[model samples]
Target chain A: MKRVRMRRLKVEKRTNPSAWTVFCISLVSILLAFVVIGFIFLGFGINPLEAYLEIIIETVGNSYGLSQIVWQSIPLLLCGVGLLLAFKTSFWNIGAEGQLLMGATAATWVALFSPLPEPFLIPAAFILGFAGGAVWGLLSTSLRSRFGINEVITTLMMNYIASNIVLYLIHGPWKGETMRGFAYTDQFPESVWLPTIGMSDIHWPTLLLGLFAAVCVFFILNRTRLGYEVKVVGQSPKAARYAGISYFKTIFYVMVISGGLAGLAGAGEVLGVHHMLRHSDQVSLGYGYTAIIVAWLARGNPLIVILTSLLFGAIYVAGDVLQLSFNLPFQIVNVFTGLILFFLISSDTLLKHKLSFRKGE
Target chain B: MKKAVLFALCLVFLLTGAIGLQAQDKLKVGFIYVGPIGDMGWTHAHEVARRIVEDTFPWVETVYQESVPEAKVEGVIDRMVRRERCAVVFTTSFGFWEGTVAAAKKYPDTIFAHCSGFMRAPNLATYMADFYQIYYLNGLMAGALTKSNKVGYVGAFPIPEVKRHINAFTMGVREVNPKAEVHVRWIEAWFDPAKAKEATNSLIDAGCDVFAFTEDSDTVVQVAAENRMPVFGHYSPMYNSAPDYVVSGQLVHWENFYLDFLSKVHAGYYTSKNLENVDYWDLLKEGSVEVGAKFGMPVNPKWKSRLGKTYDLVMERIAQMSDFQMVFDPFTGPIYSRKGAVVVPVGVRANYGHLLSLEYAVKGVVGSWPGEPK
Candidate 1:
């Protein structure tokens, strides 16, 4: 009898993958995710290809859809940029959502309660927004620094606190007088309304600010001494200690910038999107949590986050389109987003490893 | 890859042309819902109404986007108007006020109807199928059957709508048994099962045997029934959830308004420019709401005898409220607040303005009341 010959499979580390290869791999990864999602669409009796085509036409093919997608990205970009920085320092700041809510809260104060004149309202709102977000971020940092509490749990828990805070405000003191028994704050006066691009909801001010943040963070992560320290601390806390890099200061900066940026996103929601402080769910739509996927997909590159955020914006719009056209359930969107995240995460493994086939011994 | 991309583009073009051809001359109507249509309460009723109009009117084409976030309502409206070419849009949710108004201004030629909201534009109108009257009728039954004489009320929010219902229910309870108290608990949400369960359990623990609620789900009814307590269901029918436990509920018939409104739209009566004052604040008289354990079952037969002497009163109240002349209202004159403030003076029927902004607890209510008079 002929001995059964088996072909051996081996896994080896790919030291470095070029940009082109990684791009191709990522593209394939996205397509694979869509292919999987398409099957789910089939389960719902929808033609996957037609649904995909409809989404493309609605979002990129139509001007209004394009603007809405672009508008959706502003919050994600702001939150994602902040998250990538915190992740780089390995601080795992998971409370960008809370920070964003706090920022919106601060913006609401300036817009509604402050005595600031019209000319100063927007600027004052943004400043207070940033400060509000940073303060919320620092609370968790102090706990981690002083008491050695795990930041992941603290950050996640604080998100609930932030949302509840928004809930309490909108339900209580901030409930609009003319809203006639609804749970939301009064609309901001026109003086503080962020200027948009034409008839679209795209607030150029927030979009430009988010881009500027991305660029500045890119530069900081690539060129600065603090960038090097952040990498080392993230890569090895022991090495950071040996090299005399201050973990406290590095984490402090990451938390501040991350939280502050998320706050700015929150303020943008009020100033640019809703023009009022609303329920936290309405204000964010899970942008803070979704931005984690955005940052993760960017693979530590701040500039890459622009594309990732836009991709997420399109995904969200596609979800809306599905609901509009197909009458699918809300969980369909979660499943779609989850499948993409799962596939993208798996693709990250392929970027680091190569598979080989060996002949039988 | 390039060829595949080209093929995809062609498919998109063909699909676009196909959709354009199918659009034809139908009056496209769009609905924006803040919750899923299957929620079995507000949005479900709206969805049912949408289907009715779609089926009944040959010239109407309906589409909807459910679970829309209030912040994203504007975007959904844009897509509805621009992409779907919706001539008439109905946004159902109080939180959608600003978005509906903005969309009304953005699309002047488009007709917009908003539900349960105050702010309206020339192109946007507001409508609501209030059940305070039905709630009062249910309260009458609750007042009669409560063994503990402590009626538990699981309120969704302290908003005026819920407050009005609770007040009306309390009025009915007090009218029947003046010594009985209405214990209230607020869950601070329109629909939250866990919180609803917790609130119901807490109420049960406090020895309130009879129950009524303003939540979007049957959680309160189910919870109360679990403890062998009789309950009045909130929005939608709950006899199926716990048939023996649920006595009666306030049900909304949104299709009455939808059919009337859409027919008017189709007949060119409701144009884009004339909706500013066209509010459809329909109630029992208009048949927009009902008092029942389920549709066509005003009272559970099991509880009919249990109500005994109070069944006649419930029937009478329903008949009076359902009359076009409207002989009686739950919020009649000489009603006093729990703190002795005059809610309604003698012989003064609570008008639309007063009922829409009511924020007081009646004499028999026991709980924290936000926005109550000081």
Candidate 2:
């Protein structure tokens, strides 16, 4: 007797994959991560539901809380946009953090030395910040373009260099004459400070500027010929070359744009949130690294990057609430983050490959 | 198909079994730090104290993770409390304030102790030490030893804790030599070795022959020593970290403080109200705060004699103050903000509340405060 064979599940070739499916998968991943974390919490003797709720409320529940969450997301959005820009053209610019440090260092220099009036000060600070970051980015891109250096390594190394340079500046020449035995610079001048809009707890300038940055990136990535070229390069370097796009120039241009955005983020942070770029690790919130995830999750879509950033911001806010509310170990968020990112990445595997089972393989 | 079903079943069973087992543990204590435990500064100090609690009290269990960022702090705390069943938590950084406060409120039964902060709730309390007392003595060494009379300080942040230490050190410097002027470089981070070293070099180049720092790593001291400059160390016996550049340094003995708190908590005396008065001020005599290891000649002769004398005096005073009262207050009067605001008039001591609330730079301090606390 002839037996009919059942059709294999072609997970990769679905009738059509919808946004809803992606959303469901992400939600499931988050839930699964939470459940596993909940067990870990149970081992610590904590109530999982209470912990989850605490995170949600802290991150997005109330006005003050939401304001803080969004306030923190500003830097992430800026970095994420820049990273997304590089990701679009297959140019991995992991040096946004370093670039940010360079921007901060330059802005700090102007803040300390430039006697520009308030009007000129803000613009000059931003220009200097952008230029500084762009320069740092260009160096890495040029090395990659010219010497074929891997940008990931170069950018990572540059972060240390940039941060150390700031460290040296604050400690040596810019060291305040009276700070006890610390290694930080004094506060930025009031004239150069970012103004809070409408008497709100939120710094409107940073939020708006971040949104503006997102819009600008969206335009560059979607509306312009450069954006189209970037997509082609990202898809296939050889194909892009056949299409007459110069990989070296594209790499250099994207790196500069990415680094400049990061620089603006650093400047915004110094001018908007912290006002003074002290030696504190609070300068840029490691936004550059996290933005990689944001860009990837958004698939290099600038608008999606903004939303992803907000989601991360919410998670950050909620994590704090849960920590205080539940006496949760601060690392719990890291575990959650690890889980989320893990699942987010794995979701692609699920989408592309069908799971099969055998009795003994 | 059958294997897939089995895999799903196994996953469910494992998750459920794990949950069932975790439902039956005793209370957990979660501790968080801003830096790694390897760094012998803020994180190390807390870690040592945590070990004391774990070792001395067998019934109590505690766990900790280090090198957390401000943005991620809240989530870490959540996992510790909700999933781990932590009845108490300790956040070791000042940035943990708003997050910790919210956590304490959400988990009313859980207790929280925030280091170097004043925020509180019925279940949360504030805990910190008088590390500034040692800073004053450190300043004395910097003041007495500086060939250029320009001493440099490397700090973490301009927060009250750091600001107070700077003021105390400056006062110590001034007490010995009125002509001495302290220069401060803020590294803005608790631990970044290269940065700390770079700052040290910067100060050394600025004609500051004496160096000191409030950072966790001893790179600053090492940097000063490399340049043949004298340095006063902060947070514990950093002289061991830099044996060459040491005149003296401030030390934080966390065992006693942790022992006292854990003992009281174990004894059922750990309510937040009682914990308020449980603020411990460990002194040199009590072996809580040390004035550094008595050593050979300081890099500079003036520093050697002056540090010895100041260390002895501080030790003597600390020994006599059994009640932890009427001692050194860093924000004493005649203090001026860098913006020229008189923070405290001369001959007048600052109130604890005000000093703890310090937000501005003192007069003669260079540089600007960043971000939003203007």
Candidate 3:
């Protein structure tokens, strides 16, 4: 008879991981991502170290690059802060993208078609944008609460529907008469345009709003009774029920705030960046979807989202740098993003669970 | 350990950034492409032309960002101007018109040019290497080659630019085969290969034999040839993909405009403030567009024998188009819309403005045209 040896492995739930451990793990994951991407750079005949250096210098060291990062981060910060609330409530609201588009469409109506006077246009656009996104979110929430439908599928499907709505508008009644047969809208009036911080596309009104919203959300999540109920309902429905917290109500409010914030981002894109409601893709660039990564990376803390949003913003600017300077392919940047996210999620798993192996004789 | 990693990472970046920022004297020209450079159509043609521009001018250096969305156009232009110190930036694709216009306003000192757009600022110029003539030539060949008297067209979109090309092509086909119908199917996208293939198959199913297409990939050409049908290539020369079946194709020489524009910029003849009216609508006479299966060959030898009588007509048409003041044009009038209205009156050639905003389907076109006027 042959002797057989077995090695047993065990996984145990870790009660608590200190912030320091999480930071270290995140750092390790990021470094590991860079290492893998460095090999990818090598395959493309570019010096990986050189590529990293160029990205850093271009994004942080250069004024134009830094401004663009902040400009890009404004929407992300807004969306991420909103997503932080939704994630904390444990509602996987993937429809933020659709909500953002609907918000933009609503803002477009205010800017282009509204009879509002010049000075009132900007404020009205934001209000309409928020309402637009909130209403869109409510549709999904109602579906979830009434039919026990999964928000994930509904949210994702709504994105396509929202996109088609914009397409129909542009290709039909909203098509610009001055766009020379192209399917784009005429430039929004200058009064509706947001003021930018000199020479950069960093629209200050939206940026200030994002910072304000971040602080407000941070307070709401940490200081309020609703925050406590949200945590209870998300973590344990039975515990929440016993404690007299309504699951449906908590999720509904969270969905409203989340979708509204994303809508503000859409409004910002129209008023601040585009200054004209253009194609849906031209307005948002999937900032709402990317904000999921932003929120997750910040560990659902709205305050941390400020830093996380800027970091993702820098990564985007850096990707542009790699392509501009090194002639690197765009797919390589996508691979780089994929690696970071993969490692980050894996690290999260490691932080939550302890693994042990034993040799058996 | 975190601090140590941060420190090491910073050191690597600082050293590399320091080593990389050394300034060069070459006039950097940045290209903002709406599609990836690796693509086989419009972007690829421009990429190839950009390469030739780099080779032709010693003082010119080129950098480009591919797959840039229209939303990111201004941002890319900012980087190209502020970070990369690019003296000139060219925004390719029709969708980039408005963004390029806005960027042009922001950076008045930087010379800007937009392709296939009507909007032009004092600092922004517009240019297009249209394929109406080339398509007309290809249509003649398709008209001659199709036994079923039905030519299939896989269109990227039903936009005016495409409509203009199709009209000119149909005119050529009608000139050759009076009863030949040009069956068209719109993919509603500029660069989807699967859609192009399906559209091609759909046309084949509709009893059309010879094929022509305006898409970013060689899917239509490959698909048509797979079914042993003759097809015409668009944008870049795609003779290699289907040498036996390809009769002739529309080829762009974007380098001609790039070189001309850059040389003028290099010589200080064209300033940023003076480009308001610099619309480069260069055709065959300016060597901006070519009619050929490849660079040198006007028609595939294999297909030339098959084109038979219309082979001479195609050659004659090219000769007429390539002339400085050409006598003949495919759109030489007495042309009627498929709806029985005369689009072009007797002996009146379609002028530039009318051609640019075309929205009519010519006779023998068998598909729905969106945005058609009554």
For each candidate, report its DockQ versus the true two-chain complex: 0.70, 0.10, 0.49
Best by TM-score: 1
What i-RMS does every model get? 1.4, 8.7, 2.0
Q: B152-205, model 3: which lDDT tens digit per residue?
A: 998877678899898888888888999999999988678899999999999999
Q: How well is candidate 2 docked (DockQ)?
A: 0.10
Q: Please give the RMSD of candidate 1 to the true structure.
A: 1.7
- How does candidate 3 score on lDDT? 0.87
Q: Candidate 3 on A127-156: residue-level lDDT in tens? A: 999889888988889998899999999988
Comparison by DockQ, 1 against 2, better one:
1
Worst 10 residues of 2 chain A by lDDT: A176-185
Full ranking by DockQ = 1, 3, 2
- Fnat of candidate 2: 0.11
Better of 1 and 2 by TM-score: 1
lDDT of 2 by residue, B1-374 (tens): 99997996576557545743664475467888877777867788788878887887777777676767654566567667755667778888766665687677667777788876666777787777766666776666666666688888887765667777777787778777778777878766667787788877887778888777788887887787778777776675666655666777776767776677666666778964444444443454455665663322222343445465655655554445433564555456788765677778898887766656556665434444432123
Lowest summed lDDT across 10 adjacent residues in model 2 chain B is found at B293-302
lDDT of 2 by residue, A253-280 (tens): 7877888988988887777655555553
Pairs clashing in candidate 1? none
